[model samples]
Target: MAGSLLVSLSGITARTLDGCLDLATALDERGVPLSLLVTPNAEEGHRSVSDWVRERVVQGDAVLLHGYDRRVRDEFADLPAHEARLRLIAATAALEDTGLRTNAFAAPGRRVSAGTLKALRLHGFAVYSDGSTVRDLRGDRLLRARLHGFGGRGGAGETARRNAFVLAAARLVRRGELLRIGLRGADLDRPGRWSALLDAVDTALECGVVAATYVGPAPRVTCSPRGSTLTSVPSGARLVNRP
Candidate 1:
């Protein structure tokens, strides 16, 4: 069976909305829908971008709350359950004021504490995708995010990172496993970064992977870790730290 590929773009603020839109257009032409990560309190620019955001959602792209603010890195990384709940309430309300609403979440920097998970469960978030796993809250299961491609910071190691990411995509597709690629809004201005992402997507498609959206039903897992469980998760917030 062919594996599924989920493409998500984050860091979308007023400045990067255009680039994000361009990339979304390219994905749409290939029949791939993007899962957009929006930050409600990022900057003063969101008010201007609200209309554009709604347009994309109307076109079938999946919208998710990335974090409360872009200035705060790893917003959910170290919060307690009570604090997490408070933050979510504030963030979701801000998003609603913008005329966008979503229960799905992707934390900034793909880091989340166990408390973050508990808060998401309580808030009725349907799904949460972090660095290593995608948790389906309603279904109470975990899906390993085996292959990921993230935008590179400028440096000598950038090329190596891109190469490794492409190779990982190829391997996942050949093995029929889930492959996730996350692009940032800054990637468009970075030389070769945008092209590298396109290369990874093309490489996966050539290997027969189907494009997927995180907003849709959770993809069925062909394999899961033996003896692993998320059932005891709620009780172990402090004991089972992910960060």
Candidate 2:
């Protein structure tokens, strides 16, 4: 069997959401489905984007809940379970009002709390995102793909990162694991950066991994009701081979 591939674009605030949506459009044209991790409820004066998101989801694409308004902080684990769940619900509810059912949650920096995963599960989300994980909080097998390109300072340094990402991806391919590569909204601002990341995308596809449209029904296993110490998933979810 071949591995699964997941592609994500984070940081979809009001300012960058439109272009990000456009980038997603282009990817769709190429048969590469992109999931946008939208931050619901932008600060004051930001344009309301529910309509855009609604249209995206209507077209058979995914618009997963990103994070809530930057109240206490961007990460959800810092908050209590009640607060975390409520805040997460608010983000999902924003999409719900627009007739979009959210099945996944992606944190701002891929560093949300264990409570973040619980919130995602409680809110009817099956797959959890923001970082690469082989095993979800519910002990379900995840693809464990994370952003492997364009996080460097540029030039030789950036090329080094790109090569490293490709090498790491090659290793994962050999293991029959799911491949997850993340792109940021900022990546759109720099043509060179986004293009560089595309190279890594090509590397994964060439490895015979199939690009997937869905990640799943909230993990079936009962995990920690709160906090971040998640239960073990399958060997496919391990990060030992990643650089």
Candidate 3:
């Protein structure tokens, strides 16, 4: 088996501090280092969330950023576009306020345009992760990631199937080169869902990929109903301080 990898969680919405904290704490306890991506508007609504994250979560442990406040429609909405861009700038500013700088960016819903890419580059972000792929914005590397399951509108069996397929792909990829696995509970809620997601991570690890989860901008101490503990994830799998 190859060396382990990291996981990242993205698109953390506003006012989800408890969820963020709970997940982060749980993953941390388990020895899994989770990277959080946050939107500027979310910080605006829940300013304390960012404060708690900065105070409790160590630097180089989180990826803070802007997320779309609303869903991207077929017909682009000017206000949403402006807000999204502004959110990116605001997120960068917020991190700077804490004396932290994040180089990774994730767009909500993985719906990114040329304008969004330009904004990210201007802000000094080098990487972007989405449901469909992981992009090396500064380079030419692009990795396709298969979505395993969604917690919001899917059945357990379906999720399992999707996870299995993704794991298979991960296994194949691991054989070719060192790989990074990205995990997110975007549609799932609670620690149990996160724990279940770890199963996928474990699978990737066995196949020689580094697994990481995206935690978004939520705080790092909130408890989940499933008794999930972020601190319990295995530390060897974490990827820290990569540009």
Candidate 4:
């Protein structure tokens, strides 16, 4: 099988979730698969939003429970260490209620600490997505991520650079190693420059790179409810599942 392209959405704000939902609908219409990464904090007063997302999860769309909180040390620093642990447990429990459990874990920025990793394993997470790779402590499920550049005004230039980096990184991972690369277009909150983003995706695909886009902290394991399949996002790209 060719590689897969995984699109992720992280830190989906309350104000933007609705717009994202609309975007998802649009992408669904286009047949583009996507994964959503929702933070615990973002879902605070937005239980309805979660409900809506769950209701919309289709065969192409997959939901993964992200970190317990937003990973903000300042806000959660006051809580006792033990209490913090309990909070993460509670968050995972809440996600389980939503019927998404397999690939649930934290997306602590780009890196994860030993404690965090341990906690995730303790909490029943099978896979954890970070900047490096998809790690599975038990089985031999170690897969490294291939990240592309961000998308914006100078997106093409940045994407070129990112592609170069991915190529170099791929060489190091092992010849023909399956890679998961990141790709972005105009900021979803801002006016999206679809043409430019598509250009980036095309470039990456041409170079034999599997492209992916992230929304929240964790990686999306499946496609989004939106028309993720409609886009010509190469068959090799794997969309990582996010919250």
Candidate 5:
């Protein structure tokens, strides 16, 4: 089967409401399937973004757990499994309080560990994805997350990181591999950038690659011996870790 276009938008703090929505609206209008990997609440922004997220879900978008407040991004690795599970449960419950329910999750800033993986499987999560793989972790199957938004507007390291990912992502698609691309609501500030990304996605779709949420089993993957690098991940993979 052809791979999918697993588009996910991250960093959904209140300030990014319009930019994020603009990007999401563009994708939705194109009939692209999406996963709104959103932070449950923002400490500073309006609640409209969260409400909009809920509406998107009702309109057929998938919601994945991002984080609690997003301030604790770097600490995901240090969180004990019990605490991790509790946090996720709390976050999901909070979403439900807003009338949205989900069994999917993505990490915030740290690398998701074996402990986090186990916690996700036990806490009603059936699918998990990170910078390395979009996995049916419950079944030991690999999934694809091809493209992700990269580059911080001002940081050199962030720019380098995004560039590196762009190179890698391009290689995968060129090889006829299927993967998910990560999108960010913040990037919508420069509409041209997002427009270009959508055009690239359209190019991939015209090549006969599937352009929707990925569903089903994938290749077996193992933890990279060091760092978050996953060896042998398929081209159609999507997602990322925290820290």
Candidate 6:
């Protein structure tokens, strides 16, 4: 079997929109689907950016909920189950109102607590990525995915960091594990961060891995509700994301 690749972008506040656009242009026809991790409430003043995101969704890209507030670094990292559910509900509604409906999510830094996962299922999220793995929530199946990309923080010695990322991706591809390429929209603004993401993608393709979205090409598994499943899915139940 061939390895799968999923490319995701986050940190897409107004400040990082330009970088995100640049990276999106570069990824065109690159045989991979892109997932935009968006914060609905945070994008209130950025009408243009929101319009662009809707356009992308129409153009075949997936938009997943990133979090409620971009400034809250650990928004979903350690929330109580009830709290997570509340946030998820509010965030999902905000996205729908903005005309960007989605059923996938990726917590910041991929450091979500177990309670967060529980909330995801209750809220009818079909897929999620916690940095380490991508799970099909309803399907109760998961694929191990290691993220390789930019963090948006420009710094010295980035060449070394870029090289290390490339090397790690190559190793993961060789091992036939899922390749998760995550990038912050702000990375494009950084000196060499955009190129670093491209290099990582190129390397993975060269190693014979096929690119996909968070709704990966993995075989569909039977749906078995572990605890509580969403009693009724919201309208526009399209499943699609990354961390």
The digit string of per-residue lDDT tens for model 6 on 1-243 reads 445567888777677777777777777757666888888774455777777788777666777788887778888999989999999999887787667777788877658989999999998788887776666788675655557775544468777888788777777677655677888765676666666677778877877776656643342221223322212212222422322
Global fold similarity of model 4 (TM-score): 0.60
Instruction: Say which candidate scores most in lDDT.
Output: 1
Candidate 3 accuracy as lDDT: 0.50
Distance from true position, residue 56, model 4, in Å?
A: 3.6
Assess the local accuracy of residue 65 in candidate 5 as a C-alpha lDDT between 0 and 100: 73
- Candidate ranking under TM-score, highest first, comes to 1, 6, 5, 2, 3, 4
Using lDDT as the measure, what is the rank order of every candidate, best first? 1, 6, 5, 2, 3, 4
Model 4: per-residue Cα lDDT over 1-243, one tens digit each = 233455555555656666567656655654545556655544554676666556545435555555666656433334544554676678756665554443444354566556566565565555566655656544535555444435335544655554554555435223323334333222554433333334443443444544333222222233223212222211111232457
- Deviation from native of the Cα of residue 29 in model 6, angstroms: 3.3
Off by over 4 Å in 4: 42-45, 71-85, 96-102, 149-186, 200-243
Separate clash counts for every candidate: 0, 6, 45, 51, 25, 0
Count of clashes in candidate 1? 0
lDDT of 3 at 17: 58
Cα lDDT listed for each candidate: 0.74, 0.58, 0.50, 0.48, 0.62, 0.70
lDDT of model number 1: 0.74
TM-score of each candidate structure, all chains considered together:
0.87, 0.72, 0.61, 0.60, 0.76, 0.83
Mark the regions of model 6 whose C-alpha exceeds 4 Å error after superposition. 42-44, 216-243
Q: Tens-digit lDDT track for model 1 on 44-87?
A: 67776767777777787778788886778788999999999999
Query: Could you tell me which residue pairs clash in candidate 6?
Result: none
Candidates 4 and 6, the one with greater lDDT: 6
lDDT score, residue 54, model 2? 57
